[model samples]
Target: MAPKSDSAEAIVLNFVNEQNRPLNSQNVADSLQKFNLKKAGIQKALDNLADSGKISFKEYGKQKIYLARQDQFDIPNSEELNQMKEENAQVQQQLDEQKRAISEVEGEIKNLQSNLTLEQIRHKEAKLQKEVKEMEDKLVKLRKGVTLVRPEERKAIAEMYSEKLSQWRKRKRMFKDVWDAITENLPKDLKEFKEELGLEYDEDVGVSLQSFSGLLQHGKK
Candidate 1:
């Protein structure tokens, strides 16, 4: 089966890398004729590769000329080299900012836990954890050079993250309701006594309400 023709994107990228020169979509499509790829597929693959930073492009009037990312590095002029250095510096700054943001969120979680009730603590912790995780995921993608330049595309990404934040909030609310209902009448003495016994709900004890209630009942007996 002619090795399954690789992928359309891979074929397009390989052809550009081998040619080591800027090529229009038609040039790419012509080169891949042996692979029986369609012009539309070749064009889409080229666009995607460029968007992902695996390939670079130049604009000539209405046409976008595509070339392999490595091709740009191979024979860099002084200006191009300086631009690459600036781009690297920007990426490093972004990484530092993401790390600082993560640390700040962690500090906030710790501070909130100090003065918050158990339910409040859990709610804040869950919300912050979700945010931190999302940031970390974005940092990884950024480190991999995933760039989204379109405003509408960025808006879609923001909406997706907002949905995730909402889901986290809903989870925190559910857990808070369950926790408040179960411990509504829990005496202060018993609460202190549970702490004294060190039967704290470590992950080993399980995270369910039943586990906590069981520990309280055991203490009473």
Candidate 2:
């Protein structure tokens, strides 16, 4: 009975196809040692592959040398090489355009930060954030066939950004709530206690009220 075509046969054939050179069963078995396949199993897979016409073999005395069929591979000619070069140039041009777009957005963000009103800044920030996300999606699509970044690395970066964005959003809501609570209950004589209350609150440090009079006395146990 012929040996069944299984993972062992597939692995052996893939290695043979990639090598494109005549390899003995021992050679294939050695190359696939990491798979922990037994020598007998490898020999059986090799025979199955040869029988299935997935590979060809030449008998050299007592041993058979196996190789993938040459016709299965497309050997690129000059015209094909030129077409690949043109495609590569077009991808590079697209990459350059993306970089320019990112730079323009960054510059606009900086300008808005320096000169825009608070409400305008928030509006523009939200718009720029959306634009940046769209640009990132485009970058991921463009990098599909290229080796600029590995898939794992891209995933890690995306996760990191998502985590940071979530934290920022949480803090923004917290700060807004705290500001509202402090403003609504402020004393009518705001100018007299303005310096004592230390009204300058930051998102990172939170609401810093140096002296809230008797408001915080209840929690002073």
Q: For each candidate, C-alpha RMSD in Å?
A: 30.2, 26.3
lDDT of each: 0.78, 0.79
Clashing pairs for model 2 are none
lDDT (tens digit, per residue) of candidate 1 on 134-196: 999999989998873577876776666556556755776786697678668977675675677
TM-scores, all models, native as reference: 0.31, 0.35
Model 2 C-alpha lDDT per residue in residues 187-217, reported as the tens digit of each score: 6665455556775444335642333222334
Residue 4 of model 2 has an lDDT of: 42
Clashes per model (N, Cα, C within 3 A): 0, 0
Shift of residue 218 alpha carbon in model 1, Å:
99
